[model samples]
Target: MFEKFRKKSVVSESSQLETLREVLRRNPEDNDLAKVFPQVMPLSAVSSAWPGPIERLGDLPFGVSWALADPQNYFRYVSWDMSRKWEASGTNWRGLAMENLTELSRRYPYAGSKKGADGRPFVLSLLNEDSMGPSRLLVPGLFQDLFGDDYIVAIPERTCGVAYRNGLVGEEALLANDLIDGCFKVGTEPMSNERFDPKRFWVL
Candidate 1:
């Protein structure tokens, strides 16, 4: 079961990378790279919409709220599943996503850009930090390296806000807010972590 889970995780990361690359390729000339990178969404709007569930402990550390902006707005909320007991097994969830993004860019250099309904170029992934997990330490640099300085959007979750407003209610909505807050940060320091070096990301 453990091996299977690892393999599944790897596959999932690869798929996400490919998806991001495809978006980049479609909108190669798109000017709004900032919109595609990870950042935090505002609480006011998020509070009004589907917030998801909340934890009694308050908030998680690495929560992530993401959206595919452009042709249509699609949203996803991410959090660490500590209940799975992966730490003892030597699994690093953070590294999984980063490695996947890196690999995808190498395999497909012209991903990230695509045309929207308006025929204008647009980026696909728009991430917001949720206050439900550890600091989103790797997000900014990951995006900057994969995309570009101009393309990265590392706004704190307090500013970006959530995309959806209905569907989720009660615990789900509150949980969603906590998740968003956990993922969101106030500045670019988190990206400066050793793992996300802009120099390493530079293609040429």
Candidate 2:
């Protein structure tokens, strides 16, 4: 009787975990998972408890992960099982993510260009409501379309990004670095403080 009870308890626990969350993908416009976006995260940012492994992005210490955004919630991470299923259904997940990212950028365009105290110009996208600011680095030609070509970006936190034209010199470069470091130190969802040249990657 004791062994039977233990087996029954194990089965019950397994069933409970499986039923804990029922992720449904009824359609592209489904409230459960309509908007899927690509997000860059440090290798250590994710907890081991997560269901999927983050795909490493080149040789960088970051990885490419998927996020699901809906109207009711801020956003949530997508596990490997969910992403694989989405892809197997003939929906190009990466392409869809890029499309959603483009739309998100359109909705919240970067604020007007601002100049540092030293007279160097830069652009900032620091929206507290939008947590995908760092993910902007994954979208090629995005900065070029808005601020022209040859630009570098610093995404210190998930909700903030600082960008400036390439070939910065002297104090201007120092200032950019300082800005990135400062944001990174204080950011809640700290991603990276390194500057990135979007031209290096052919994001599509």
Candidate 3:
């Protein structure tokens, strides 16, 4: 039933990413990603075991630099977006995000959704420390609450808990953390201050 999405896995990140890109390339219909995150293709592979590449700190996938960045656009490529099947189920993620953002915009004033890719709805919650209001915490849950839609709250470098929903797997999140954690020295932030390809970090 969930043909348009992939969930958690136990494989290596490189292998999964390669398989995902290959599947999307072969299918040639998931052109929606070309608009925003053209780097991320679709997936059809089911294997959960892969021989990961030997990685180092310099070789790790650099996450988006949170230093003086626009959280609105930054989040569009990261937050929870509904699979088409789930949308057909009548749970519209974009609508919910817009509604919540509309209400939250009354105070935060920096919430919106950018359609860089198709199918995936990237929700933005940009607020300063002073106005860290409900939207920061509530919006993600509201979007991910659709039936059969599973997600996890991930705080990238003290930023808001941007929901990593869409077709992302918990294993991918783990791989990201593992790569960053294993690379950096103790206590150093995994979400780096340098921007890297989002496709290298997570497979959507």
Candidate 4:
């Protein structure tokens, strides 16, 4: 019975993987590279088989990777094979990715400024309706306009990123740390507990 159950599990896994591959397969026009965007994720969340290279975010354990969004199927990582093809076609994938990401940010209407218990101001985007919470961290200029200088940023959960003004003090600072720790403790697809330096991301 044990062997039978193990075999069944393996088969189920294989079927699911195949279904994902099928969903990723696209025709020429459908393979528009302009749809590609940069995604921020913890190193642990990435698998060995994940296509394309993972660019480290400065000294942080998190990394920036590329993904293409399929309106019907959500999104998929850009495969090495596809990367090569795009390069051969003289496509600057990174530039394309950034352009798409910036445009997507314009469409994200869920984020706003909020005050902590101690009346400290911060900008928070939780569970972005577009489902690109952590990715928003890449848009430093946009958030910086709202947050100004002397602020810290955190991407605790996959769908949550916050930028707190005044560096790390008062109730807002404590709240940011608590949110990061709580997300990690609860295994809520946590990204990072460490405050992200947007400068590091700019180097990419």
Span of 10 residues, lowest total lDDT, candidate 3: 37-46
TM-scores for every candidate against the unseen true structure: 0.24, 0.69, 0.24, 0.75
Sort by TM-score, best first: 4, 2, 1, 3
Candidate 2 local lDDT, 135-173, one digit each (tens): 766666667764588788776765676777776667667
How well does candidate 4 score on lDDT at residue 47? Answer: 59
**Per-candidate local distance difference test:** 0.31, 0.62, 0.32, 0.64
Candidate 3 segments exceeding 4 Å error: 1-116, 122-135, 138-140, 145-148, 169-204
Candidate 4 Cα lDDT to native:
0.64
What's the distance in Å from true for residue 133, model 3? 6.6
For all candidates, the clash counts are 51, 0, 2, 0
Q: What would the TM-score be for candidate 4 when compared with the true structure?
A: 0.75
Please identify model 1 stretches exceeding 4 Å from their true place. Answer: 1-84, 109-204
Q: lDDT per residue, candidate 4, 110-151, as tens digits?
A: 365567666645646444655676676676565666566556
For every candidate, C-alpha RMSD to the true structure in Å: 19.2, 11.4, 18.2, 7.2
**Candidate 3 positional error at 43, Å:** 37
Q: After superposition, which runs of candidate 4 have C-alpha atoms over 4 Å from their true positions?
A: 1-29, 45-48, 71-73, 109-112, 116-120
How high a TM-score does candidate 1 get?
0.24
Backbone clash total, candidate 2? 0
- What tens digits encode model 3's per-residue C-alpha lDDT throughout 1-204? 111112334466577457644543454232132222111111221123211111121233222210111335432221112234335677543344445444543545333333323544333333234223222432323443321245433333322223333444455444434423332222122233232332333321
Better of 3 and 4 by lDDT: 4
Candidate 1's residue-wise lDDT over 1-204, tens digit each?
012112111234346546644554454332222223232332222322322221211131223333323433332332123212334567553345445434433443331233345553333222322221112332234334433553322222322222222233565445444433343433322221111222222221
Question: With candidate 3 superimposed using the best TM-score fit, by how many Å does residue 183's alpha carbon deviate from the native?
Answer: 16
